[model samples]
Target: MSGTDRRYRHGLVLGKFYPPHAGHHHLVRSALARCERLTVLVCAASVESIPLADRVAWMREAHPEAEVVGAVDDHPVDLLDPAVWEAHMAVFRAAVPEAVDAVFTSESYGTELARRFGAAEVGVDPERTTYPVSGTAVRKDPVGSWTFLGPGVRAALTRRVVVLGAESTGTTTLSRALAAHYRTRGGIWSETGWVPEYGRTYSEERLAALRAVDPGADWTQVEFGSEEFPVIARRQDADEERAARDGSPVLFCDTDSFATTIWHERYLGAPSPEVAAVAARTARHLYLLTDHEGVPFEDDGLRDGPHLRPWMTGRFRAELERSGRRFLLVTGSPEERLRTAVAAVDGLLAEGWHFADPLPERR
Candidate 1:
């Protein structure tokens, strides 16, 4: 019989496999059906959040027929580096009994690996599966995207949402509610559990590093100079370039380098010509949350002063108007905050905003 007619002896699946979800299961099942033997190599050097053994167990439970293997430990290296590919290939060569007949991957690297190993490579189109998903997509909306995960995997993800906000706002209450909502929806809800006050996290080490840097360094002097102003102004231009290349929608950021420049001038008293130029180039869609009825001021550690609320709100609005950007003022109780945020997201979605990052294209 020809090679095509012969039963494939072995197949390999490689990935981080943080928690094997539906897409992963579909790929494994397809591979198992096509090959006499299957091996799964789970990358161990993922983020500190998930353990390697847990990832292996997740894959094993989902594909019991496959021989699941953990990747060999090596000094962490950046995957983007050209040299890393050869190093990774060495590891794979050592782990498998012999060069596998076929390699399975969702990434373009699968094709490259096939060329290198002299084996048939298959790029599985994950979108064709029962629940098409990706790790990055899963990370962006863990609670809402739980349906794509397996029963055991969904339970594990419940404990890992990160909610970030600035002082005196209802971030603490909101964070708790978000976690509770995830649980109520029958998924894992991971957060810090309580809002830890801001300064509690900022350490003296950062302060010392800032102080150690020379105020009159050549780079600093150049940044503050007129000739270098336009060069620094190109920071936003870079973001625009990225957006163009990826066909992603523009996000009107609440904070930008321009705001940082203003804060430096106002709080640090370090105004410069370059700072003005930087501020002038920033594009924004400022959404100033204003004081409203029933939104009582609470004594959170970061928001203790009585005058800061109105003063900061006024300043924020003034900055937006001065900068000549489209803005909207949102004011109301906690319920109103949620409504306003949801409405803004919906508006962006309706406008067909595409994310710059690699993700499933908006339907």
Candidate 2:
């Protein structure tokens, strides 16, 4: 039946949606167009890698036009046995509130599902012609399947790569290089190039504001206090999250909140709980530590001093080791550093690491 002629009062679309991608979005959107009220059942099993609640929330947010519900099926996927159908039918009946007039699906199993529901089966992109992507393909290589993800899903899957070290250690330079490289390879989904160091920009702008208000104030000796570190940490995290939401497959962060915590220890001679909390929350997948060796320290006005370079680098190393975060020490020319960092990320990809997977532990 034509879409305009056949409108269902109630439609049902059911799927595991391991990590909902563009195809699922297309299916749900198409279904919503034909039904006055649609119900999307996000079926999740215990053995699934992605959390059930998370999948339901994703579908709910993605399709606000429809009523989305989470359905948990602890039993194994035993499609061949007819006995399992009765149990499956019971689960569906309990999850869905009302009678479904139509069922929307892209799989062959839709025939049986519709039969059980006693509803008309409506197929969408059965051959995968319209949106040629699947959850299985996404789970294998999320970065490779960047085009098939929505902003919310993409943000969740964006792998944060932080380039950090003492001042004048080429952190900004390397961060940009890595971002450019990823963009060329179709990794970055955002137009902003990369997630730059928000702390640096924040400090500079604040210093300028202070100098403007009080011209006689010694802005050169601006003391680092607990008050500012927390602000910087939060800003840095927000910047990174914005990049992810904009569709960065591999987000290159100049410095993360973890680096902010280390800096807090350096400047205040103690730990800031706020900074530490932000650091723990915004942890990155990989870190490229820019070594201070052979790099001449230039006075950027913001830097503490040339003598503090070694101490800063040492502190960063100690913190990284203590936290047991995965890191690769990068040094030498800009080209060499970029090459090394890229290789390390490639190794991570080779391990079947997908951004949609659970965040890796500190290692």
Candidate 3:
């Protein structure tokens, strides 16, 4: 039969997928090409840090056509022991009860797995050459294997750094500098991303639309509605997510959704529960609050908050502390701020991600 034609009536692909990488996706894709119907079993153990449901979701998202399911298989791996093998098979069978026509895998145990199911063994890439990556390698050094990871996994694992503070406090400058510095590393680091403040774009667009209607209209004539904060916050959050998914290990965002809540207060003179709710949707690792003391606020036509700088800075500090968000207050010249920000970001990265040890003896 031709490769495009389904050779198997049913097929199974199983793994811990402890944070699915490209290699896992390759195997699933290869299996789908050969089977009329396929099931991806994400068998996670109790000791794994990543939740079983998350693994199942990632696999499902990556291979939407396949039936993706999860099973907690805490039982230790002992392929040589018939009793242990039977225990695993029971879990596997319970999760995927239908008889398998073929078992597709890049693992050496595919032969035994297929034999137990009375199915044929189809090995996609027994060697690591096709995609030289594994769950162990990912867990050990995610930054090193960043490109091998898919967007969902990358978004989940990326270290998000937010540069937010009073206007004219060098948030944009520092954020751009951080992204550029990381790009100097070359390789995957060249993809280091920086998310622009969506609020600025919104403001520019609003002003332009207003000027189009009345040629004399300016920033003073611009108005912000309380309802608009949530929209900007959501858009900012989405932009950050997009950048994180495509960027390197670290993502630099100049003013994030959380900052939108503060700007809401600046414009509307009160807190906004709507914007705060939207801001809570995503996680940001570190906040660099730039102090407005030494820097002169330039009236860039879009900003009239120079007089409110101290209050804004104080308010940002209070909110960050009140909400128990991790942050660092930065001061001095642009050079000093960049140096301090880099040190803080490097420190955050030094504390590597912690992935709980999976059940002993992996396939």
Q: Which candidate is the best by TM-score?
A: 3
Per-residue lDDT of model 2, residues 59-86, tens digit only: 8888888999988876545666677777
lDDT, model 2, position 58: 82
User: Candidate 1's residue-wise lDDT over 1-363, tens digit each?
Assistant: 665345578888887765567778787887887789999988755333567787788788778899998874453454455566678777777777576888877775677777767889876774556666777666565545556676455434322222222335554454444334333433222221222322222323334444569533331221222333234335533442332222212122223344344434433455556666665553433333334234566653323344545655565567667767554565567677656654553454344312223212211
Clashing pairs in 1: 158-188, 158-189, 158-190, 159-190, 160-190, 161-190, 249-354
Clashing pairs counted in every model: 7, 0, 0
What's the TM for model 2? Answer: 0.89
Order of candidates by TM-score, top first? 3, 2, 1
Ranking by lDDT: 3, 2, 1
TM, every model: 0.42, 0.89, 0.94
Candidate 1 regions exceeding 4 Å error are 1-6, 72-82, 126-130, 159-363
